[model samples]
Target: MDEKKPSRMYFIGKKEDLIQAKRTTVTLDGRDILLLYHQRTFYAMDLQCYHAGSTLETGDMEEINSKLCIVCPKHKYKITLAEGEGLYKATNPTEKVPTPRWYSKGIKQRVHKVTEVDEDIFVSVSTCPVWIESDYYQSEKGRAELKKAQESGDAEADVNADEDV
Candidate 1:
């Protein structure tokens, strides 16, 4: 098996600080990233929604399909904490099932690994090419880069074509 090298980790802040703040938006390399502390675990992801440019720091966390998800306050889109997978409950129009089935939109959010050492917290951006990129990345050049990535088969296809704190 091939082993991958670890991504560079950026120092966030003290775990105590996150525990007190619950959620925080940090600037990394001039880009805003959101850090969330919930259920005794830490999560780091893009600061804004992948669908629209709304903030995710105010988003509510809920369990969907047995996965911890952050529901966007502006549009109610559910994004998972484990790997930033986007999920939507789908219902059968013909059948009479009351509960809707969940489907994956295939990682629509860019998530990072959070590590805690004693009292300090650090975050490492995912090495994979994620589908969930927004903010300044939505510019013309950014879109062109995205297009190139898609053409190179690095970008995942979308269900509805669509992140997180």
Candidate 2:
């Protein structure tokens, strides 16, 4: 949390900048992390939507199932702020009491730890292997392949592409 960066922690930017913008994307150790400020708390997660790689920095915020969540602008996938849990409501209109049930996709998105120090902020990428699912969070090769696939009209390729080493 201090000016002396820790072994894992990486300096992101000034806290004042985040306070003004509300949301930002920072490249830490190679990953694009989305840092959000909502209700006086800081939330950090993958910068792109886990479902389809849409930029989450442009997403909207709302409360879902008593938890703060970011609604993906592209597909409206609601992801919890505190934890990277994916939320979805199961619609079963044929039940005795027709209602929707919320379920977790088991942390489809990756999140990191954030620390604040005076006017500065730092982030440490999660050690969980879940982040490896991202096309190229750790390198540019996966990103280039993803971009090439996207440009070639191969929508399914992105889903099957391997992570960059």
> For residues 1-165, what per-residue lDDT tens digits would candidate 1 score against the true structure?
012755778888888888999999887644567899999999988776677545688999999867999997767888998888888877778886666788888877777789988889998866664345443344455455556656888542222233322
Superposed on all Cα atoms, model 2 deviates from the true structure by an RMSD in Å of 5.9
Clashing pairs in 2: none
Q: What is the lDDT of residue 37 in candidate 1?
A: 91
Q: Write the per-residue lDDT of candidate 2 for residues 78-112, one digit (tens) a residue.
A: 88888878888886878888787887877777778
The CA lDDT of each predicted structure is: 0.73, 0.74
Model 1: runs farther than 4 Å from truth?
Answer: 1-6, 94-99, 130-165
Q: How accurate is candidate 1 locally (lDDT)?
A: 0.73
Model 1 quality (TM-score): 0.74
State which candidate has the highest lDDT: 2
TM per candidate? 0.74, 0.78
Candidate number with greatest TM-score = 2
